[model samples]
Target: MGRKEEEFGYLLDNNAANTEVHTKTGSTDQCSQHSSTETHKSLESTYLGSDDDEVRRSQAGQSCDYGEEEGHLVYHIGLLLEERYEVVSTLGAGAFGKVVECFDRDKGLRAAVKIVRKFESFREVAKSEITVLKEINMLDDDNRFACVRMLEWFEHQGHVCMVFELLGLSTYEVLCQTDFLPYSVDQIRDMAFQIFKAVSFLHRNKLTHTDLKPENILFVCSDYNLEYNNDTKRDERRMRSLDVKVVDFGTATFDHEHHQSLVSTRHYRAPEIILDLGWNQSCDVWSLACVLMEYYLGQTLFPTHDSKEHLAMMEKIIGPIPPHLLKLTSKQHYVHNQRLDFDESSPSGEYVRKHCKPLKHLQRKSEGERQLFDLLGCMLEYDVSRRITLEEALWHPFFSPMRTQKKKRS
Candidate 1:
């Protein structure tokens, strides 16, 4: 059969950015074609295989001797799961679960089926992530946010399969390709605005994306034929927009109810959260600033460190909040001074004293760096009550020029 006529089926086009598929007769042919395209040049040739090299390498490292036995096991598992989708390749494996390649028989579609292992805690987190995704999908029908869309969910072989739209490259992958090059100011603004829109939508719906980072953002190609150069003029000015989709909602939580658990990636975690204080949707606002700073600066705003060092680092940047604002902290000691005392020798006091030096040193950086640092620092304050609100941040001068530049470019 011809390429287009070969038992065609529609998959949840996970590519997000580039949707067109230029098929070839074989994997070698596909590789050859892609090799000639500048945009795809950096992609490892093994990714084109029906079964990628990573899977082969993993299987080779397996202790099992029976080749057919393992294949048979997977086949039986697929059969037991109703065999609606053909297992094509493995996307990723993790402590929590493994995601496999699958093609849907009913729709003739491809999907990433995240298989939840039998561990109790693993299953719980997987279910929680699924719940978060479902909530997000139901909240917005337009799907403007960069979120992975769920195709289907089912249980089989003592595991739960979450079928998701397979995405192409993550921001992590793109960053690797560019060798950690900072994105153009326009690119930063565009990405930041889109992220803000997504966060705003979630906040409006009483939800908070507890984890926000570069790795969670996915890219779509505005022009597949175009080269992957760092030239912003060509990529930024393109009339057609083909990039969107954010993935991994495992740590997301609804803000309507108060949550006490300290959940968030370390570097992105707000100071209130780190200090074991009650926080609201504004925590996400703090993280958003950090993520945007990393995009523009090609480095993390506040690098990760031990809890003690991290607290010290925070104090250095935002400075110790006035006692009036300290009283607004949701923590009992700050509220009533009953449970704990904020004496000079206390952990809190020591953190504040040690961090003061670094904050003053950071003030001596370049103007652009200082501007970005100041903007992010305002939101990342240790005192939640003293931190800048999302609405106030949106009106800040740092973003005003960015907004004007974006409008002019558009």
Candidate 2:
């Protein structure tokens, strides 16, 4: 293997659970700290409106031009926000805006700031995210799933900025660093426990996290950059060891609202979302099942971007969608009279989907394999009403061993 591939393989070599590497303890002082080597540049913005309600715009040549190109608000380094936090680096770019690493002068801490575009729609969504975050914070004091905490929010430079506690690399990054190798069953269990617990908390609070993909799931540790020699070696020796937290509430909504049915990224999106069926917290369970399968299989369970194609792949893998669920959908373009018709005959005289791969490794009849199969089946049930509850999933025998071990440790 080449150097990059070799480094990726390092991430999948170990399967033992490392306690230190999986600590979920949170600290107020556990903020990010930047190295002095990182560079910063000054920012100049054109001002508009009154002193109390000024909207700032980045000066030409100093901004990322995100606003002009994709309608997202532009951000620049060295921008002093709210006379407190100073932008140090662009952390990541997304559809709304960019997440930047900022230094808080008063708190003497580093934070991740998510800057939303000043567009009215974007601002409204961003406001909703803040509202959801506050609700989660007020209710979840113990941080059961280690969900990301919002420090504060404000308007800065024609953007709605949200300050969050800095988090580590995402599960997506972990998979990529491992060259998409299938994670061990033990590791998958650990992640599922944390994720399911988080989702259960949200559901109990009457909220739904419409997006639940690998990128939205993050590790709690700081130094997750596997490029570092020491960190890489240490992580390789403790493969699948991570303390995970769910992030991104921009698309979340109260279950009663029923306003968002088209939320979630395309690949991990639930069937309800695609068929225009009004969804509740159960939709997140379907998305979570897909993510969990991806961890064990090292690939997305359904990989099509087109709605019809995605539905077809689902049928091939999980069997037909329930007629009742199909009837609930407002959009019937993907569903024909509560039925999906397709030519199933293949060259091998067995039905096969062009996108889905055969489950070779899962052919084993081990206890762990059987348990996972059952858990996935429950989570991916066709009818939302029949789907497994997060609480039930937590107590499921698939995770019973882990729960017993955790109890013994406590």
Best lDDT among the predictions, by candidate number: 2
Score each candidate by Cα lDDT: 0.53, 0.62
lDDT string for model 2 (288-364, tens) is: 98888877766667643346666777776787788887777776665676786444574221323444544433434
TM-score of each: 0.64, 0.75
Residues forming the 10-long window of minimal summed lDDT in candidate 2: 44-53
Over the stretch 205-288, how does candidate 1's per-residue lDDT look in tens digits? 777767665556665442222234474343322313536565666556676554745655555677677556677888888877
Please tell me which predicted candidate would have the highest TM-score against the true structure.
2
Candidate 1: stretches off by over 4 Å = 1-82, 221-242, 321-378, 389-410
Enumerate clash totals for all models, in the order shown.
Answer: 10, 0
Off by over 4 Å in 2: 1-76, 222-241, 333-338, 344-352, 357-363
